[model samples]
Target: MRAFLLLLFVFLTLGAAPARAQQPTPTRVIEALYDQLSAYQLRRYQPDSGYQLLTLPSTFSGPELAALRLRERQLVRVDLVYSAYRFDPKFSQRQLNIDRLRNLDERLPGLLMDPSITWNLIEQTGCTTPDECQQYFHGFVLYIEKRYTKADTKAEIGRLTARLNATEKKIERIRAVRKSPGKPLACGYPHVEDKLRKLTKRIKKAYDCTQKDRRPRTVTFQAEVSRQGKVLNVRLPAVDSAGAAAPPCPEELTGAIAEGLAFTDGFLLGKQRLPFTVTGRLSLPLRPQQGFKVTGYYLADSLMRKYRVKLLRDGCQARQLRPGDATEEDPIPNPDPNVVTRVLERHPDWQKQTVVADVTGSMYPYTADLLIWLQLAAAGPEKTFVFFNDGDDLPDKQKRLGQTGGLYDARTNDYGRIRQRVIEAMGAGGGGDAPENDCEALLRAHQLAPEAQDIILVADNHTFPRDTKLLEGTRLPVKIILCGVTDHINPKYLALARRYGYSLHTLDTDLTNLSELPDNQITIIEGVRYQTTPGGFRRVSGRAE
Candidate 1:
């Protein structure tokens, strides 16, 4: 009686089944060779010759696996099977798949590195893992693609080299621009400096006797003034030196000081129309006889000046501020609440996850949100992140779908390093076009962390993926966390989700059934009507309320 036949290694050893004529001994070389073969299969392709598959009898082992070398051909898939007569007979499909996956995983690295191969072995089916995939009786399959000619390959390498060089130069240029401290604004008018001094004096007087605590207190305010001398915006620091929230000043005092600063004239300026910011810190007196002390720095024409305060018995007086060493002009903005944290918190199962985030200019808030999550979350070695900034400032015309290469990777528990990576990617490039190389970034991220079970993609809902066509090549389950979405979901994301069966996570809800929705079926999300299509979802009405 013949037993059930399954692919690769199996436990099906029941009654008698015809075994292959010869049984070969298993060796580590064969395992390593299989690993190498799998490595080839995981590579990205440029539409070369297609992949091929080969199956061998479980009994047909030994050096045969290691001896495989096609002259110009690539081995994309390889399977090892167990002879039915020798192994245990009653093996379920689940166990069989699990065994096969284990075998494949045992040799994953060789497959990931080999450029000659091209097929995502782990994601060969709709399911990414063996546990979730349905197993069927099938022979081994190898997929391959033809490579470029010798001359073409050389030329392609040269082109890529030049592109890489150009991208590096672009990044350097961005760094230089950000690091430059411009020439100081030449404010020739002496009276303008006098007005700034008097303004601080009035601010100190307003804050006098305001605090309930008798001890010394420091009140700080940052204000931006246009070149024309008009006070633009005034804000108190959210937090002080000790990490405590800055105590709020009386509204009346704040209003009075703002008005006083606005009325002061003679803000001399240059040809460039940039705002000069003032950061003032007023230290209240420690003793009854002592006066309030006010000292701070202001940037005028890219030059920094430190105001000197002299304490008097009655009240401190302000005088000319000496020119101080230049520093970054603007204070860092406070981090705004974002949806990335909210979405991730709701899904606690996203463990050992690889995060791929867009670090473009508009997505800075979301990027900060990710950092906040990392800082506050439990510490561990499991977190891995990839930050991509749409090609390192590459010009729109020069960027290709899969090659738009501004991707930075970090795998560590240190939140600071992850933050630095985000800043480097952001400073290098902040996407030129409205559409970003989202799929390209994701694919690279997958390569960076193939073993990661959950891939969390933090994307911009407003920007569609420039490389949406490449989505099919990725072999992981991607949970897209969309930021900056307002009334309606971007139809492009919906389309990708629909075709690929991805779940879309927004600030409030998750659309997991997009892929399973029947064609032309209507559904409502957040008061928005959408109809499912074969390709993706289409909005049937206007923006959602």
Candidate 2:
């Protein structure tokens, strides 16, 4: 295998059936602006206290009108692209950029929003999905093109002509008094008509292409590059509805390139090889039946036996199971053959099982499996459930201050209602910022179901438990029913688990008998297989064997 293959992942087949690729729609830009930043335009440009980059600035006699119009459109284009792109998690340095925009400095990380720059910043970032970033950029520009119809263009041309006549009359009056036409005015206005004519032609061409090219055939990869320009490593990552994952870089396709596929500078940012991260897609002409082991990427990352060193965290407080860490009692045979069902079976004597879940947008997608979990594992009268949103649901929750605040809008009880709440929240669609109030929910669940012996915290791996302070007083050992966990386990979560004696349990959604699962429910980072342990993913049997 090439060293790049070591990085991880294989080709991702984004769609099925024969059709052109999807086109970008500009309206999404408007929608995102209102959704994230709470920004909405009341009407088209007019003189107002609010900022409007495209406000009709002045009547133009010649080229300046062309210059101003071009500048305004460029800024508008930047505004539209950035507004949409910011929503993507990979676009980091987000908080800093958002802070600036919310404060009214029309600048983005790359573009200053200055009229002087035409914004070549349209360059795309490399990623696991090939050409996705650049393709989106093309879609955005075309969206802008399609948004302005031919009627709208004609109207603008007529309006500019009117402005030109007025300006020309004023210039004639001024010139009559000036015998000494000292320095010739460096007005670029004379070029406006030609410039606009060319612009309209270009926009029409792009619009036509947008109509013709529904999708582009391409692939994207993400890698850590060294100063030497060598591929230090590459791996495809994914996100769990419960949290997030690195983007997918399909392996079967990647491995197809073998040891030495050199991506041109198109994949790299700038000419310099200084250590940095790069993610991009390249167009590839691949044929069907080209499949290899697309599942290995996940297998290697999530199921690999590599573990943390013996000692863990501040003052060596965390403990790893010694090699001989088996209980003296013969292992409790799992009643449910399903890999995930064995999680609750960890403590056989426990009569009642209590599940405390982070039932948010991410968890909602797994509703089918969730129903399976409830029906199969949590169905008995001995089982009780507690559900809540982030910290806001609990009164004692502390605020993170500058970072994300708890968005706990949910609070419910009973086994029956729990399912409905999770589905509703999932459909309603606000996962909130990264950190959830999982701590408070856990704390509350403990109080309500104090008698339940085995407490399972159904955690979304992306969000960390912020209520460690409450856990400080927790007497009962909590077994984490880790939901949506994939290839990479957050070391911090493991550290906390070590400190609290919480043994982690994840699902193997691929159980032959339980194949009703939708794609989102199986949260592994990449595709991998786990050994059939007596209880969950407790050990790794060489996957190859």
State the C-alpha lDDT per candidate.
0.54, 0.36
Give per-residue CA lDDT, model 1, range 354-398, as digits (tens).
Answer: 889987765755776777667556576757788887788787568
Indicate the worst ten consecutive residues by lDDT in candidate 1.
36-45
Measured by TM-score, the strongest candidate is: 1
Candidate 1 regions with alpha-carbon error over 4 angstroms: 1-336, 542-545
Question: Model 2, poorest ten-residue lDDT window?
Answer: 291-300
RMSD of each: 19.3, 38.4
> Which ranges of candidate 2 are over 4 A from the true structure?
1-342, 345-352, 365-367, 377-379, 391-415, 421-429, 508-545
Name the lDDT of candidate 1: 0.54
Cα lDDT for residue 6, candidate 1: 23
lDDT of 2 at 533: 15
lDDT of 2 by residue, 125-191 (tens): 3323534433432211210111223344344434433543454455444445332222221111011
